[model samples]
Target: MSQMGPPRPGASMPAEKAKDFKGTFRRLVSYLKPRRKKLAAVFIVAILSTVFAIVGPKIMGMAITELFEGAYGQLQGVPGGGIDFGVIGQILAVLAGLYVFSSLFSYIQQYMMSTVAQDTVYDMRQDVNKKLEKLPLEYFDGRPNGETLSRMTNDIDTIGSTLQQSLTQFITSIVTLVGILVMMLTISPLLTLIAVVSLPLSLFVIGPILKRSQKYFSSQQKNLGRLNGHVEEMYTGHQVVKAFGHEAKSNEQFDAVNAELYDAGRKAQFISGIIMPMMSLIGNLSYVLISIVGGVLVIQRAISIGDIQAFITYSKQFTQPITQTANIANIIQSTVAAAERVFELLDEQEEVEAVTTSVLARAKGAVAFEDVDFGYGDNLLIEGLNIDVEPGQTVAIVGPTGAGKTTLINLLMRFYELKGGRITIDALDSREMSRHELRHNFGMVLQDTWLFNGTIRDNISYGKTGASEEEIVAAAQAAHADHFIRTLPDGYDTVLNQEVSNISQGQKQLVTIARAILADPPMMILDEATSSVDTRTEILIQQAMNRLMAGRTSFVIAHRLSTIKHADLILVMDQGQVIEQGTHEQLLDKDGFYADLYRSQFSAKVAI
Candidate 1:
């Protein structure tokens, strides 16, 4: 199949081309370290197979020599002058045995090599997956999902294929080259020298092509990842594209990336393609050289006609490996390039280790952010920010975009590390607690409700593993979702498609609320949970949320001022700092930033 186009943002393109070809080659080979036993066995079998094959040409030469001697004796009217059928039969039988052994050994070698290659790839894939899990969200935030996926699939697959095919070919080619050289020398050193002379010329033709092709192959893999990223992004946001009338723009961008990919692929293939015919041309030239030289040796009686025939066969065998080695060299370059990409992912910085044994049992929902300072990177968004919330207090945070509203929740849940100060739950430092235990204390319902392709019951119960049916239905009822769910054709048993388009957005939001309700944590975060629903559905959801938040500490991030009007505390924020905090009446009485925002929204609603 053809490779993909220009890279996706944050896709697994090489950060830089691998400058150390030998180092990358060594690291790629090291993946086989764990399978050394199988590899060693494969090597031994390969050697045995090559040895068996090498004996055939020499034996046939001997058989021909025997026939020539017998015929000459028969012409002299001497004893044993006629064809020696017995000797010929013995030689033929040995040849058949050699051929059979060679085939058997070759099969065994291939089986073992295949086992080693697949097992190594399995280990690599496992390590990459585990590494992904351990890596911090920051690493992912900087990269495209499709790029990482391409590395996981396309790059690893390339390594596996190269190992399966090229590895065996490489070993066989080397052994065949050496063996043929030895056999040719035994027949005639002069002919062997002629065969040896072609090796440098073959390298001369291959070296520059291999060097030039490496960069293009690397580019091809990068472009493939880029192409995958584009497709994934366009398809994932296809609705947005249509709404914005961006289909033509999307196609134009895709074509641009596709054209670059095609160019890279063409250049890579074209450069590498030169190796085969060039090698073949050199091989043919070597064959002709050996033939002429061997014929002279035969005419001079320095070597028998049988030896000349064997030497010519050995010459072809020698050149064949040289050609194969050139091809394998190109494959190795590609494999090494792919290996570098995989290793780059494997080498990414992982999240800071957490205290695995720390547990927060029955958290009372008291949250404190004491002199907390934070930033996405170096911008220093939140500096010396302090907040204290009593258990069961509803804190509604209102801010323009990029005001670090969500960053507060991210820090509370330990999704991102705090740069300064501490966050405490109850009386204990959150950093001292395990992330799982800390996060378990809080339940979140995001604006974009995510529902998996499963039954409604399954999606709701996902929040609490092993939740009983009774608990699921109770949570759904509390979220006011049970009635709507039961109205469906299959009720709670209704299976949602991947997009969950079968249900209305309000219903989807309700299901996510039900999931959070099922978790029933002491602390909750509602990020614009009711923003997208119609007025009637919003009322129903608000009632459900009010009940859900009655005695729990809640953090509500709402753009609509009306939903948070009854909050115990409203934090009005801008540019990562809280500009005002109070109830709706107090904020309006102050006629500050919060009042302005509320008035603006109220006026917009009035205009509507």
Candidate 2:
């Protein structure tokens, strides 16, 4: 199989490698530790089943030998020695019993294993979910949603499937191999040697194929993740693609990723596909050699023909397990790779621990950023930035794109840790409080209005769980969303689909505003909350925002200059520096950068 070269830029998921297999396997086994008793039961039952199953060939051999000897004696003129019907019946009955018991034990083993597998994966997924909640926002910020989704879904699913399928098969294959090898040895050691000798040849044929297939399988999984990410990202932004006439380029990129996935998948499948045939070929050669040697031994009276038959059956059984084990070996490689991906996410650095200090109960909404220096990675975007806000003051931040306006907001919320400095609320550093408590103090309405698949009432109440229906209605009324909610087909009970495209963008913004209003936090952060609305809707949103912002410290990242004209303090930012700061009129009177920007908006309005 050909290895894939460097991936296309942004058209790939993080390339997955088979790393720390032993450690991952060890951790994986730890999931089974709690269910050790059940696993032990499964192990014992599998062994008993294989033992029972292996006894059949030897028993059948004895029955065949008895019949053969009886017939031979009759041919030599013994009158009543033609056949032993009673003995044959007994042997058949015992064989049936062995088979029945074997099947029963096998069934029980499978049931136990299924329970163990499901339980282990259930615990694993729960741990991963908990880990996700504790991870810093930057962890997600630096990766694509699809990559995260892949680990949570696809990689975990791989672990689940391998557990459910491969784990039991692996145990069964090993047990069967040992059982058959023992049975063959009892029947004829020479024939067993022939069978055992073929083992090395099988390995010689399979080892290289497996070693090569692993890389392709790893590549295949990665490409699959990338393809899923591309599809998800493209579909999520489909409207943008169509609006900007970028569908051709999008399709071209999708094709490139899809082709990579196909290449890796085909190579992996093709390599794994060769294992069974090659093993069968080796088994066949061994069988011929065993048959010739057993025939010669039977003529020499060293072994019965029935023993030869039994040996042949054992050889077939032996090779079957070997083939299955080899396939399972390949599957384990993929499973390990998947487990590594899941464990990597589970091992991500969590948010910084809250320090022990006085908790800020009933926050006064006064916030301060003191000597705050921070960066996204190594790029120092915000340096020595300091700001202080009084209770119930509206601070409007205006900045060009990438001017660190939102980054500042992110720091204020502790979504990203400060490189050096402190963010304090009510004179207490935010790090002193639990993240949940710290975040609970602020209600945010971002430019992107995200509404899940739920009712209008549910979306509104998302900010305040257990909020009564009446409270939901009140919040909607305050956000000027109540009338529209009532006008909808199902009113508050309307179910939203995954896309949430059922409502207009302005309506979605209203829903989010209703959510924020319901939260009723001490502080509010509105980042262009009205950017998605039309002029009329913007007027309504602005009015609702004014009501929501009442008696709360608010940080408004304003895009439209007119919205912030009445703000208590307007901050003008350029290239990550505070270029100007004062009341709107005061800043405008200075005739500086603020004035030029404020004038440009009106000039554009006049031109229009």
In model 2, the runs with Cα more than 4 Å from the true position are 1-9, 12-16
C-alpha RMSD for every candidate: 4.3, 4.1
C-alpha displacement of 51 in model 2, angstroms? 1.3
Tens digit per residue, CA lDDT, model 2, 331-434: 88888878888888888889878675768767899899898888756767678888889999999999777777887888788788888889999999888888
Model 1's number of clashes is: 6
**TM agreement with the true structure for every prediction:** 0.92, 0.95
Tens digit per residue, CA lDDT, model 1, 1-608: 01112232433343356666888888888888888888888889999999999989999988888888789889999975888979988998999999999999999998888888899899999999999988876677666777889999999999999999889999999999888888887888777888899999888878888888888888888888888878888899999999999999999878887887899889989998888888888889888988887778777888987788878788878888888888888888788888888888998987676665446897898889999988866667789888888899999999787777887887888878888999989968998887778888889999889999999999999999999999999999999999999999999999999878999999999999999999999999998888788999999889989988989999999998899889999988787688899899999999999988888988998899
Best by TM-score: 2
lDDT of 2 at 596: 93
